[model samples]
Target: MADEKRRPRPAAQYGPTAALVARNVERLRKTRNLTIYSLSAELGKAGRPITPSAIAKIEKMQRQVNVDDLLALAVVFGVSPAALLLPLEDSPRHTAEITGAGAVPADSAWAWASNKRPLKFPPGEQRTAEMEYALASLPPNAREARQHPAGRAIEAAYEDVTRVIVRAAWSVEGDEHEFIDALDQARASLERTLAELGRLAVEHEELVRLRDGVPREGSD
Candidate 1:
């Protein structure tokens, strides 16, 4: 058996988020007229040396991006890392006049397009219980729509995605087969995480009602 075949797959810990990032990456890269090869060369000049193929994989969500990759991309695009991570709605506003690929003033061409402030979590391993506690303590009424376990899982999953992207972007020696397998497993885990969070939310609400001395919908 070939070593590549024997190795585990790449985990898709941040599958959807990675896919979203990839779209943004592609969109922004195009805005700057960068081909995949050009982007690869730029990264190589910066000591990262991401191959065109790997870049393709990332954009396609078949691979991941790491912290280093994100940083390099930020530099290449002349945008903040936060800009790269911001939701699609916050991507640079496009105008027909600016669509032709020539020089565009950064200020007028692209501003973080979000009306609301985005949540800022500590990047990488620095995220700890303090963050979780803070998230949990947000007034329940204030967060009733999105402060659920599913939302937190999505946030954590985004972090995991950045890690996976870093690994896939920087490590060229790993078994490709195993790396791909890891991605598959990670994606599965994310799906399960979402499902489990939904189940827990229902149970948690019922428990909260009981603890607070509230009756069930049909109580005597």
Candidate 2:
């Protein structure tokens, strides 16, 4: 029984998410120019050692990735665990096969994996109280602010500005024109983000007033 448990199962027996993880692990390893041996070494340094043979089996979908393996791999690859579980392609037209969820749009799969949305909605297409509680239970960084559309726009704008600033700081000689253009773009993005923030602040204040039963200005 132990030998049978140790043996590699047929590909059909592996879950869809497991197959996706195997493919992504191999892809990310090759993209980073690391061999299985090197990845194994890195994993060992990360305190979750897997032999090269086991890593090879994992890449080939002959072995299952446990939760600890998933977390360790994410750390080694410098990515979130969701990145390994979801499809690399984010095209809405394409589909990803999830184990219990069956096939869902690739983008939706990514959103669900990243906690931007639920994997499946309740009947009537409304979020349940449990779902709301689950979302509320997330850390502040992982909650609605980061997942909401407006918040995402703000975050994206910040990233754009940060990217430009980094490029400018490390800019090579004779790249003045390119750096200036990037600075202009960053400035525009920052302005837009600021405007959005101001709008949200006003909206929040109004909500507070309403919740406190305060009358609107110039109203009876």
Candidate 3:
């Protein structure tokens, strides 16, 4: 075998990383339609005092971000603190769901019911955990398409399959067996939605890769 020397890969510049994070901060600020003044004010409200010019400097990559500043910025942006620091770009979140009875009319009654009475979920089951499971399966960047804006639409779809609307209406009159069936259906729907979300996440991997200037190796 012939001895061959391997070529060394060039290191990426820090300018890009700083510039990218700055660009992201500015993009988020602009997309949210926030003025530098407003952003500064908000940071103040979050108990961090910093000038808008400081934010601008950070965005221009002229200044570095401290832990408190980063945390303050994250609070203003409604994103995770680590997200602001990562070299990769993050996709926009899902659409916002309007909370109203028309969307989930059956459960709508409970909106006020819980206000009047103490509600207790059954043993060996949890609401937040189960819902989080469904949510966790979703893309880190949820489908922001018209059909499924907020990730809640996925839950809404599951509700449809489980006859959540009907179940809520009939639950008072129906037997435990009927309610159980409805929950079963809901679970199945959640399972299916989770699978779909997983697929989208894999597809979204390309978007993240692109940010790092990583090319698709197989494409000639």
What is the alpha-carbon lDDT for the whole of candidate 3? 0.59
lDDT against the true structure, each candidate: 0.63, 0.81, 0.59
- Model 3: per-residue lDDT, tens digit, 116-217? 111233466655543444353434444233124234547555445546555665678865676678778777767777877887787789888898888897
lDDT of 2 by residue, 8-89 (tens): 6446467888888999999999988999999999999999999999999999888889999999999999999988998887
Worst 10 residues of 1 by lDDT: 109-118
Better of 1 and 2 by TM-score: 2
As for TM-score, the candidate ahead, 2 or 3, is 2
Quote the lDDT for 207 in model 3: 86
TM for every model, in the order presented, reads 0.39, 0.62, 0.34
Stretches off by above 4 angstroms in model 1 are 1-11, 90-220
Between prediction 1 and prediction 3, the one with superior TM-score is: 1
RMSD of each: 21.0, 9.4, 24.0
Question: Weakest 10 consecutive residues, lDDT, candidate 2?
Answer: 125-134
| Best model number under TM-score | 2
Query: Rank order by TM-score, top first?
Result: 2, 1, 3
Candidate 2 vs candidate 3: the lDDT winner is: 2
TM-score of candidate 2 to 2 decimals? 0.62
